[model samples]
Target: MAYISYLDLPKHWGLERGDRVLLTSDIMQLMFTTMRNGERFDRDAFLDAILGVIGEEGTLLIPTFNWDFCHGVAFDYHKTPCKTGALGGFALSRPDFRRTQHPLYSFAVAGKDQQLLCDMQNVSSFGVDSPFGYLEKNHGKNVIIGIHYTDCFTFVHHCEEVCGVDTYRFSKTFTGQYIDAEGQESTRSYSMLVRSYELYEATDLTLIGEKMERAGVAHVIVLNEIPYRIVDLTAAAPVICDDIKNNSSRGICKHKLQ
Candidate 1:
């Protein structure tokens, strides 16, 4: 396998200037095909490639989610660590990037919206005030790398929450000790729309992703044997909301909550 430079990311990812993108990716694959000075994976080059294309106008959001807060553990703003993937850790290591405050669902944001995103008072993990909501307000793009949208796409929970789908899921609160960036500690409570697993089966989004693909909002591409799906959340949100509104059972989950 040959190497592709950072210059090739924009064309392959279908990025444009001033675009706000949410990246759910597996960056470890870079080790297989990319190397910086023959030492390790060219992760920095990967970020540089995306940033170069997005320019000063575009904003990049990488999920820095750590779920220890839900397990009654204290969340350290600076060191709780990202359980999602290598991309979040990489972004957190950069000086220009700033992380949002939601301990379970925070994001490492960069570019034009860095301050705007970091400034959010993350009171909820998936509410109107959450980073997910702000991104939806801006109609951001959901970019999946080395994975399929069905396998991920937590953004749909935002749709389900706003659209009101308590039939299958309901809002739940998790309170824990939160350690701030300034090293202050306090007890805090956050909300997430968790599944009613006892009533219905686990949420499956395979069908929903297919629906978006058919609606022409979700697109799939392959580069260097890695699969990528880019969903225009702005265009696809309506499709999901409509499905949930008309047929909640058919929208995301397989079984109807009883």
Candidate 2:
């Protein structure tokens, strides 16, 4: 029960240089964590510590997902705000971080692969062409802060979509006005695998993480008394997609489907 300094993060979190990390966090859960080496926590300092450890060779992506575009609302790539959390807004506020282009599921990206991530123009929100797919193929990790990943692993939908899970989800498209970096506007469309009400209530991705930890692909780590899960998307996607394909429970849902 001790306050941990930012410099000690690598030892506890296993963050290394040249790594690619996609993070989703609940920053409110960190409000009480002002004690950093007997001084108040500086958000920028925390980010610097992580980015410094990862170095310019690594990449950090913070989810800035805004669903307004999914509902036919216009999405401004430069102006629309983050609806996910404060961490995303913080990333958005940083000059070093650039936002991705997918309206419904964009991220604020920094470090080495920033341009590549910002350049992504995926047709489907969770398909192989999306950032989720990049994380899966590029040896990226899904990092969770202050919350259990089961509650926020949007990547699960990516697996279901790519695996063509027909029982519990269906592809749906939304069209809206999109404003790009050049200030040009155009009507564009995006697809997402919407959950089916006929199938099951909710997905249970606990098993996916369990399988990974058991196989030693990844593990949950704690830093400064906060639970953080940094699991390889490459490793976890297989477990999820396979279950989506053959699990009688219909892609690891809360209840079995008849």
Candidate 3:
């Protein structure tokens, strides 16, 4: 059984009124029934559940994985159903934004201060053509959160090895544009990747924590059992990985709880 309850998560995670919360894919699946017997995708219900948590001015963070882009081409992970990518569903549902080209990096928003930082690839074919692109345009003060996996950020490292440029020299960009159902166009851009490191040593946790703090995010709760170090955030960073050999399960890091 899982340790957290999606319905009761706000209270369990100690979320106060007006606090923003992020949900991972595992949490999303556990909370909403988008798939019934593995068939229909309940788009409305999924969106409603998310909106329920994000009342107003509240943010939700989600990781967008680009498995398809990395498979065989970049980091080959020998596994079936390996060609999947990640998208911020909340961002997709918004009104002012729309994803343009390169599904992985092309989220567009209409607001002046809206921020989305994606570090995954393979988003080229993710139904980001219609209303998805709409939300990409109006991202103003509302926060549409995005995150990258520990391994994906290594692109910066790859650039160093291949181009001889420092990780600091590399920058990722995401662009979005508008199009009618029949197809017309307009565009915008944002930075995606920041830094890189080797897989074993690569982790954006510190940066993630810093961003959360800057965003005024209060409590961060982990559902997995993977052990990790909490660098700059005040919340308890728990290990929720199920693999016993994983660092969290083995308590490899003293900062992590077993």
Q: Rate the local accuracy (lDDT) of all candidates.
A: 0.81, 0.80, 0.32
Tens-digit per-residue lDDT, 1-258, candidate 2: 676665555456777789898878876645566453465666787788778888999999999999998777899988889999888888788899999999989999999988888888898999888989999998887778878757788988888777776666788899999999888999999888877877668766677667667877668877777888888888887777666666653435664463
lDDT of 1 by residue, 1-258 (tens): 465543475567888888899989876664565455254556666777888877899999999988889899999999999988888888999997889888889999989988888888867678778877877778788889887665679988888888987866888899999999899999999888887776667667888888999999988877766678998877888898888888764757765542
Minimal lDDT window, size 10, model 2? 249-258
Ordered list by lDDT, greatest first: 1, 2, 3
TM-score between candidate 3 and the true structure:
0.35
Candidate 2, residue 155: lDDT = 86
Better of 1 and 3 by lDDT: 1
Clashing pairs in 1: none
lDDT of 2 at 72: 72
Spell out the clash pairs found in candidate 2.
none
Model 1: CA > 4 A from native: 1-7, 35-40
Off by over 4 Å in 3: 1-5, 20-22, 27-47, 61-165, 172-182, 185-258
Error in Å for residue 35 of model 3: 11
What's the C-alpha lDDT at position 256 in model 2? 43
